[model samples]
Target: MAISDGETWVLASHNAGKIKELRDILAPRGIALKSAVELDLPEPEETEPTFEGNAALKARAACEATGLTCLADDSGLSVDALDGAPGIYSARWAGEPRDFGRAMQRVHDELGEAADRTARFVSVIALARPDGSISRYRGEVAGTIIWPPRGKGGFGYDPVFCPAGERRTFGEMAPEEKRQLSHRARALAAMIAAEFGS
Candidate 1:
């Protein structure tokens, strides 16, 4: 799909951090963006079993509801030791109130042996048109979990997982720096190249 200047795209998510990230990534191409929150879009049910399923659900819902091009992303931290768990349920891992600290602690507890601490952040992005046509992209970054939670910059599992070749966790890096190396960013880059041609 060719993206033309002035074309508006809806990002099917209400998270401010995600909205900001999408805006930053797509703004340079002259695409206008609107978030789900801004459009008062309903939260679509993520009953799907995989990231691809969840992403497509949101993208389809947003496109059908607004009659606009839409993009949706579903991402999570999957630990090798946890049997790829906390996959679709990452957001609910901490229960009601969404305490990421608690969720991280749970992960640490589940993987008692530090040798089993290896993990990766995975992201899947789906883009859909009002007519139901869709395209998907995926990306991941390998890392290991730290016990004490090292940084203060990012949200969720950022404070504990340190990406390969980096001493500091993502939470220690500036948002822009993190964006350059994050799984979501990598997926978005691929989507852009695939849809728009480098």
Candidate 2:
């Protein structure tokens, strides 16, 4: 996974947002990234029950498809009061068009008047090599849900999520600011530590 040995690797995701963030993170590191959408690879069914499992499924699928080293990300928002719901189904909850606004509202409606609004964002990054070796890393951030939403930056349930001790919502923070506390960033950091090291 030290990527210092490879010229290019597949980012096993059709999500442009995810790809964009990966590109931003990887490009400066001297790694070339190709998205599954860009490669026209099929997205495997995320039937796995956990983030790590799903990430492995996607990474393996893409590696099998293109015979290249592939990396995939599976992440979600888990609401404590909601009993970890919307964790694996984070994207599905947004529906076909990916209307996060509706998803946010649904959380608001479902958790009506609850005192405990604690939540967390979780992420898992899986990398599958062509030789069938795989490595996984995880990251998370604790936060609380807010009402009426706020700002307009990050995607998903970001508008309503405020990281612990932060005055602004994830949606209100700048991309750089958000990245500092982002689950994905933490996951990537772990991946680098395990695979690339300092």
State the lDDT at 198 in candidate 1: 70
lDDT of 2 by residue, 63-166 (tens): 99999888999999999999997999999988988899988988899889989999999999999999999999999999999999999888888899999989
Which ranges in model 1 have alpha carbons more than 4 Å from their true place?
none
Per-residue accuracy of model 1 over 138-183 as CA lDDT, tens digit each = 9899988888888888788899889998999998999999998899
The lDDT of each candidate is 0.90, 0.90
Candidate 2 TM-score to native: 0.97
TM-score, one value per model: 0.96, 0.97
Q: What is the C-alpha RMSD of each candidate to the true structure, in Å?
A: 1.2, 1.1
Worst 10 residues of 2 by lDDT: 1-10
